[model samples]
Target: MIPRSRTVSLLVLGAICLAACSSEEQPVQKLRPLALKEQASNIVKSADGYAVTWAGVLSNANPWHFGEHVVATIVGHDAKGAEVVRMDQPLDAVPPGGSLAFTGQASATQKPAKVTIQYRPAQWRQAARIASAFQRFPTSRVQTMRQKDGAFLITGYVDNPYSVPASTLVVNALLRDKAGKLLGGGSTFVDEVQAGSPPRFILTVSGLPKGAEVAKTEITARTWGSTGRPYEDLALSGAVPVHTIKPTSEPFAVDRNTQIVSEYKQ
Candidate 1:
């Protein structure tokens, strides 16, 4: 959600400025140069296993401003190396020739049917705000499994064909057995995708405690957008076979690929 303060500022920027000058103005023209010379700082916060808050301060040549937004995502591997899911919240006005501080929240919970990504370019807001209107579908299934040597692995995907940007989605994963037993013994949090072009993804688990054995497993993934707001939820059984591979084993892993499905738009 956008902060009220920002909404007001944007309104003023758009309204007051239109009467004053929308384009070809000196203050606006100097924005690009000053932005290039601005100093920036970043901060990260965990909202859940799936989401986080990103805050920063950027100072330039003229005024002072602040920004707040939310972001979330999923990270994994493709046929190449690393894959991604992500999305970002709308930002506020920037100070001309001045400094501004901003914050936003992002998530990776595996819930939303469509993936999301953080967009920095000027054209992103219009598209995402429109995409936000898409209906979120249910995951309907989830499962997990463990390798022989104490390492853990999980895999699953949604059936929806809405085709959202790859940058939006926070994936939270947990492994369980056929009898609903905890194999890895706890839930795991993956890193944020921030922003990327994607739909298909496979991620690897790191920093497993020595001697932890994962035999069989079940999985749960919740995905969301700004403020940890869920857009999709996927829960299913038999998603992964437990006790098959060893976490210590390298060959065992996850992979995602985008398949184009056909449908008639009303």
Candidate 2:
């Protein structure tokens, strides 16, 4: 028979091994779900067959991490609920606590009555430069014009808040009706957006259904690729103030310190 002292030692060793295995087997933390803020699709008849276009905004719910290289699978369906066309489009990274506006097009021989979209889960990664998370490009002098072909032409100027120059900036515009329903969207690119001098951008939203009235417009600007080298360079440049000062509402010609100025002059 085994001695009592030896038996006790073996039991202790086995207990320690069990605890270590349990710790190693622990599961990793689960990631939060990404939100689909809005999406719109349009199918137009073409000479060859039909043209399919789609635009959407995806939001990263997790405020700390960037969603990298998300893929979207688009499936087109005919009137009888038959699949006609399928496309797999790869998109850029979605910023932390921010949204990604993306657009794509496909050709279909058969007219698709509708289309459905699905997104693969994103691989989360830490920010290359943390300050990039707070960077924003504010737009000014924004205007929307309607084309005769039932499309929208959006014109605007985007200002680079950072000291460094930002090339390849993407401008996105979303069209909405009076009832707040998303009609369609479009995207444009602007280059050489500097700190003091803003660059102009023009985006055209086409392939919209006839008689679709656009009562409101929503516009946003962001770096071409949030996790790419361009974005990381901007982030590493320097820290920018979280807030900017706006011009006061008082009239520019009115001088509030007139009394002090008069006394000093006397």
Candidate 3:
């Protein structure tokens, strides 16, 4: 019973109001990008050209989310500030509430005066359980040995804290100086780390500046995948029994008296 033009105008107005209300009810979500905590690079003269090695640490500010499929672009510039070489390094996932230490190598025809790095935004995924259960891979019996060539050989045992077995995992080692500055770093992989049965790993770090003194070493472990499917599956499997302590009300006997000992001669 209304004119056609007026009816069309009222319909358009009603649709705009509905759209405005819908937008108000469901707003777009904004995510914060991952932060680059620290980074370092080394360039050495090679037989053909220059060999470049780089290390970096990516930090996830979100404690309850995992940063997936992050990529780093390394650029090498000559003294003239011209790009000589570039490499795209795909890195592993940054665990929730933790940092990821990664290393890579590349070859350049010309030596670069300095190198720079850039990172791609990571896709965020919320964790199914506590971050510690799936992401925390503990290391023990870690021993660092310095070689005559000024390189370091790091050996250690990595334990599985989840119920699922990790077919493969990456272990990273960072060498620091007395002032807590990173000198160099390296990585290694381990296979078949089962619950209650850990595997041993050996990593080597080299390409440091002359007379560089290493005062300490830092080691870390994580699952090897962009999406961390192994860790995610472990989380869905439920909580694991990380502790072996037995709880009981019954009392146990203990000998508190000290006995005299006799020395034996060979």
Candidate 4:
């Protein structure tokens, strides 16, 4: 038989142990589903095979959530519903409250009757809201010049307003006709931009449809964290020190008239 005091001490120790075990068990957090808008935009025949282009936007529903290692799979199917080709594309990261534009290509030996796209998120976590905190650089002296070879050249300067260096500056240009119909699109990536400096970028888009003249052009600029390991880039290094680059829109005519259509707030 145990003494009253000893029995009470044993019971107290057991209760403390149980509490400790409960505290160590953290509940799994279920991330919100990612929204994807994708399609097979263009298909062309090549000597070796047929090339298919897939383009779309991937959005994160949670305003305070961010994800990494997101992958997109493109599957081409034949008339009999048989898989012809499969390609996987990797997206580094998705900003909170904003969407990422992706373009992927796949080559098939035979012509595919239909194509399908799917997105998979490797990991999701609650992240600090920083999508709106990016400082947008001012774009100036935009020009669209037609090359001798028929390719279009879109040139512009981007100024970084943040104190730290920004990496992975991506510039996208969409060429449209007089009726606002998209003719073709091109994108270029800049390695890095120093603080308080403007960098000039030249993007060339080839293979425009025959007799397809570009009447209107739209340009957008965006930047992301370093392509290195996670958190290596200053933008994703920390919540307080990181800054985002807001999206900017500039519309211009192929004849050289430029105007600001709209600006996305950071």
Per-residue lDDT tens digits for candidate 1, residues 1-266, read: 99999999999888877887745546532222223221111112234543332323333343221111322122322234434334444433222233333333345443233322233422111112222233332233344444664444555443332333222443433333356443222222232322122233343342244554444433333243322222322111111222566678565253322222222321
- Evaluated at residue 237, the lDDT of candidate 2 is 79
For residues 35-113, what per-residue lDDT tens digits would candidate 2 score against the true structure? 7788889999888899888888899877667788788888999999999989998877787677888877889999999
User: Model 1, 54: alpha-carbon shift in Å?
Assistant: 22
Cα error, candidate 1, residue 91 (Å) = 20
TM-score-based ranking, best first?
3, 2, 4, 1
For candidate 3, the TM-score is 0.81
Per-residue lDDT of 204 in model 1: 36
RMSD of each: 23.4, 8.3, 11.3, 12.4
Q: List runs of model 4 lying over 4 Å from the truth.
A: 1-30, 38-40, 135-153, 174-184, 205-218, 223-266
How do the predictions measure up, each by TM-score?
0.25, 0.77, 0.81, 0.64
lDDT of 3 by residue, 1-266 (tens): 99999999999999999999887856645666888878888888878899888888888877778899899999999999999889998889887777889987889999999988789999888877677666578899999998998778999999887777888899999888899887779999999888778899998887777688889889999888888567778767765665678977665464323222222221
lDDT of 4 by residue, 180-263 (tens): 765666677766676556788898765565577789766766665312232224444433334467658764444332222222
Candidate 3 structure lDDT:
0.84
lDDT of each prediction vs. the true structure? 0.34, 0.82, 0.84, 0.66
The weakest ten consecutive residues by lDDT in model 2 span: 125-134
Clashing pairs in 3: none
